[model samples]
Target: MAERSIQEVRAAQPSRDGDGVAIYRVAGMQHAAMDPVLMIDELRSEQREDFIGGFPPHPHRGMQTLTYMKHGGLIHEDNSGNRGEIRSGGAQWMSAGRGIIHSEMPTVDTRGLHGFQLWVNLPAADKMNEPDYRDIPAQEMVTLAAAAFDATVIAGNWTLDGESASGPLQTLAARAGVLDLQLQPGAAVTVEVAPGDSLLGYIYAGSMLHEQRELGPRQLLITSHGERWQLLAGAGGASLLLLRGEPLGEPVAQYGPFVMNTAAEIEQAIQDYQNGRFVPEARPLQ
Candidate 1:
């Protein structure tokens, strides 16, 4: 197997989204070639604050969205009639397979709110599958403690609590892994990967030394995976999202709101939305 070393770190740029919410784009819509994991948009809001009020009713197809909140409350409603609220340390994992209309607006709160949204892409074979949702509370997240680092297993197969994280919004196992990690200052962790796999690290809080490179909040480190890569926290500890995935190795034809393998399919998706065939009717009042 080959070994990958940390290449370089790029600063995350700020972009605005729904209801004036600011999105510090970590990936997706910004860089190309990274698959399965698209973008990570962070949000914070307060009383009478309009910022990041949450995304209104929108349409998504062929992908999954993971909403993990650190603080505040979020109300989620979808055309499937599934509605719920997520608080701090909770996550709402929704799959927009085939098609789905959804809205995630924050409820009016006094103490404020903060959270991050991660976009994951479904493989071509599963793009037209059925849509679903998984609500995972903080307690449901299997937490593990290492000598210098702590990690929460989100999905796929990971040994935490002496077992693996085999649940919703998890590791697709098609050359992909996502983990939210918190490291104590001066602590380090090493992750192994396949030579053909790509490694992406996004710093959400604090700072870290990524293979001798300093990565701060909202910064991204793109590295090549050969043997393995190491991440060490700087002073004051650090929190990060570690992502690894095998290359799709296929042509990506994407436009506004839709991503597919070919241009013809992209056109078909657009036409379906325009013809009101992709979006379902709004839920009836109780």
Candidate 2:
């Protein structure tokens, strides 16, 4: 087995989105190496001024999103006539297959939020499938408790030392493996990932050592090669979001919320929205 090394490291850049809500974002349009993953946003703040205006009703097409909150809440409503609340440790997975309109408004509180929204590109064949939505509570996701670390499996499967766990949403298009990982201070461990899957680690708390470089909060690590990761937690302990998925290797064209395979498709998406051609309603998840 070869050792996993860093293909690249990126720090989430401070940016504003959705009515000027502050966020640390790792953008995707510029990075070809982050195949299947189009974007990652880490939203963290307690002040009302930072997150008062949430994402209003918006249109989306041809992509999937997974929202995970470490601590916080969000009220979600979509054209499907469905509404739900996502509380601490809860997650929401939505795929705007053909098209859908939705809004996500945050719950205000002293604890605020420490959460992530990740986008996964879809294969061209499934781009126009029916939209899907899911809200999963913390208790529904699989949890792995180890001596040195604790992890929440959000999607796909995780196996270590002959023990295994699978996330609730197994049908994600990219076969994504999403994990919220926390390592005790100074603890070290090795993790095995699917061979050839594109991988990323977004650090949110404390720091982690990868070879000689120490990655702190707001930093992201991508795989250069190999299937195993050597991770060491800093003295203050560490927490990170681990994501891996098979690359689609397809051409990507995106305009705002719409993602497609070509510029023409992007333009068509815009026209469709304007023409009211987008799906007017969605079917509830069965």
lDDT of 1: 0.71
Expressed as tens digits, the lDDT of each residue in 55-81 for candidate 2 is 888888999999998878887888766
- For each candidate, what is the lDDT? 0.71, 0.84
- The TM-scores of all predictions, comma-separated, are 0.86, 0.94
- Top-scoring candidate (TM-score): 2
Best model number under lDDT: 2
lDDT of 1 at 152: 75
Query: Candidate 2, clashing residue pairs?
Result: 7-224
